[model samples]
Target: MVLISLGPLAGDVHLLNRACKGAGTHEDLLTEILIGRSNEEMFLLKEQYRRTHNKDLVQVVRGELSMKTERMFVMALTGTRDESTFVNHQQVQQDVETLYRAGPGKIGTDEIAICGILLQRSDAHLAAIAQAFPQRHRVSLTHMIESEFSGHMKDALLHVSRGAEQDGQGVYRDTQLLEAAMAGMGTKDERLCYRISRYHWNRPRFGAIKNQYQQLYRRSLRQRVEGETSGKYEKALVGIIEQN
Candidate 1:
């Protein structure tokens, strides 16, 4: 079912397993895994190695790799841990710092690649990422994007960052979401209406991100989309946000 046999992971797995059997140092397996393909599958391999060999996979990974290779493996494996918001936050902080150093102009597919790894994490972790970016970069990640990124990539980053907020549940609730939306709008009745709508949307348990917009917002997230957007343009933007 999985294409593992054909990817960078193939030989890497055998090497890792051999190393886990005490035939090689932890560093050896770490090197192989760092260069391996398939993050999700690699996570499983690390778990398997630990189970079979009684080694801390991440510890080995840290000892063997450095720089971008190290960062990449760490992000991939740490994200796989899933429940540790602490790890997610730490990785995000590091990545945001890395991105800031690279500056807006240097951002590339790797930025999106690492972001893809991060999105697998819970919304709480992702939201913290959004918060961390501005703090670290001394600029809103959104503003940075507005300056350098455009079209789908920009849209994707915004969606990912937006989802970082409270697993994105807050974005749907009319009361909670609208309040967030209208926080600085300086309008009372509109804010009140959004507030009234949110309580009914429920604060948790959106089946998917879009459901939050559809049920909680009382309009598809697209239909309600504002800001330099309207009509089908809003729909397309909302659609992107919903998907990410």
Candidate 2:
């Protein structure tokens, strides 16, 4: 694969189209791109998806997923998440209570209640919620999602929590995704390409992602790439990540 780019936003629309167009949905691709995006970025992605495919990204994603997972994406697609950095501690406490009652407070999880608060809140709000959740419930939001949900919804919610905890720059989330692309076995070239291109358009974020990867894994991203890949491919990945 060439790891082509029309920039991150454009490439995202294309990757999403490809994820949804075929018989099999690339759920991981769909989840990471859809979740954790800023409201403006989400708006542009939906607009671009509509322009490129003449299809609403929401409906397209809804068609691919079912039940709670579908609703999660639908809620995010509204592009209504509060973007303000102001964290109303009162509202954060309220959200924390709602989340606990929705999941741990009751026998069956109230999926909508959980999704609404997480998906619709700002990162500052989410950061407060994350801080308060464990303080109140004694378990992290990540663990709660793992216990209360399954499959794609779980993954998506975990993405939301981790992104929030990282202050919503998504450095940790991107670091995990980037490493996931290169982990376990043969490299996932297409995903690796898409992920690199996604951030390469923003040098600062790309560099932050590399730094975060090193912080988490104790090795530079370039070293890991060299271990897993070779020749021109390795050179390209190393070059992209090693940019000063």
RMSD of each: 16.1, 1.7
In model 1, the Cα lDDT at residue 48 comes to 66
TM-score per candidate, chains pooled = 0.36, 0.93
Q: Which RMSD does model 1 reach against the true structure? A: 16.1
Looking at model 2, residue 204 earns an lDDT score of 81
Query: How does candidate 1 fare on TM-score?
Result: 0.36
How well does candidate 2 match the true structure in TM-score terms? 0.93
Q: What lDDT is obtained when candidate 2 is compared to the true structure?
A: 0.84
Q: Which residue ranges in model 1 land beyond 4 Å of their true spot?
A: 1-83, 87-89, 102-111, 165-244
lDDT of 1 by residue, 135-198 (tens): 7767765566556555434444444444454443334322244435434544343323322232
Candidate 1 CA-lDDT value: 0.48
The pairs that clash in candidate 1 are: 123-167, 126-164, 127-164, 174-198, 175-195, 175-198
Candidate 2 lDDT, tens digit per residue, 163-238? 7665456788889988988988689988887787777778887878888888999998888889988889888877
| Model 2, runs deviating above 4 Å | 1-3, 166-168
